[model samples]
Target: MKITTLTNPRQTILLTSRAGNKDNVMTLDWHTPLSFEPMMYAVSIAKARYSLELVRSSKVFVVNFMSCQFEKEVLYCGRHSGKYIDKFKETSLEREEAETINCPRIKQALGYLECQVQEELEVGDHILFVARVSKAELREKGKRLFHLFADKFTTTEE
Candidate 1:
């Protein structure tokens, strides 16, 4: 295993966005908090991802924090393509309008951060979207899902 495997169990999120009337969601694990005062967050998406184009065109997205209960849905979203199939239609996941951004948030998510893209930088094979949190909320109490390497996942004990 790579040393970065030590970073295993990174928080798993469903990045939701909209292009015109079409809504899209994708499973993502490479994201982080950037600022505090303005409450910024960043997510790294590959250039070929359909959601990347949607995010670029819409300039906004919702980081829907999922829980362990939705691991199957998470894997489904990650393994499939929004260009070919409707993720929501294929999975049990439900969506709702974000508080600030004009995108959808996962209803089954433990929480969500509606963000507006502040900057986009080319980071090797991925585009890093730096965003300012326009709205944030915790829907309920649950242990967040974490991605560990490939098909493995874990969650907090409590």
Candidate 2:
């Protein structure tokens, strides 16, 4: 009887944001498109997460779609905290300036969506951020990463 397993095979993404001079990236499995009329997106982030405050203050974030090649980076970001180390520096994940937002996007990501926070509400221990897509970058097609409980990942590659 494992609840985590029930939510298995979920999409994994790298949520990036910048508050003033600080930038951070975290692995997120709880996010989705909430609307189509206005092209809205939402992400569920814990209150204690370092990126929560950054997103709150900056009111902007980028969702980086990682491919199977970035599995190591995805896992590394999930295991480490931005409060302790510079994830980009430690992981050597390159960054590129987002077109519509002040934050940066992962250069290695298969694609990226720049979002501006439109609304926020508390959902239990997590804050649900509703955002509007301001810009997007789609790179070469690749296998997207999906979380399959714990440290396991499933991809469309093979």
Candidate 3:
């Protein structure tokens, strides 16, 4: 069985976090809503990823729902890394303070959920971070980007 086939054509999201002076955003496709009552959200990030380290130290992250307009920015963040460059500056994505967390959310996002880390576990090559949503914000609705496996991404409006 191919892992690519298993995780194909998934809705993508932007995961943001901050550690000290370092803030970063990364394209995430392995995320889901776990519960409604407690407003739980989970994201599976590779342990070796830079964003994972920031999230681990900060214990907070913002899940930004990007519109189709941000497909280029998403690919840039996913392709590069925060270790060598400032993603916010490089991508020119505006960062705004999260409601209940120290991290920042993408200002251009259609919606966002600010989360505080509740639990984490090492699952295979990735670390599953389950967080409780402390606050959320939604602006004018728009089409969202969905990764269609490989280098392909389509918009929700399509």
Residue 144, candidate 1: C-alpha displacement in angstroms: 1.3
For residues 1-158, write the lDDT of model 3, one tens digit per residue. Answer: 76868776787899999999999999999999999988999999997899998999999999999888888899999988899999999986999998788988899998999999999999999999999999977887898888987679887653
lDDT of each: 0.92, 0.90, 0.90
Candidate 1, which ten residues in sequence have the lowest lDDT sum? 1-10
lDDT of 2 by residue, 1-158 (tens): 86666777888999999988888999999999988777889999998899998999999999999988788999999989898889989997998889898998998888888999999999999999999998876887888999997788888854
lDDT of 1 by residue, 1-158 (tens): 67456776788899999999899999998999999989999999999999999999999999998889999999999999999998989999998888787998888888889999999999988999999999888878898898887889999986
Displacement of residue 101 (Cα, Å) in model 2 is 1.0
Clashes of 3: 0
* C-alpha TM-score for every candidate: 0.96, 0.95, 0.96
lDDT at position 20, candidate 3: 96
Give the TM-score comparing model 1 with the true structure, all chains together: 0.96
Candidate 2 has a TM-score of 0.95
Give the candidates in order of lDDT, highest first: 1, 2, 3
Return the number of clashes found in candidate 1. 0
TM-score of decoy 3 = 0.96
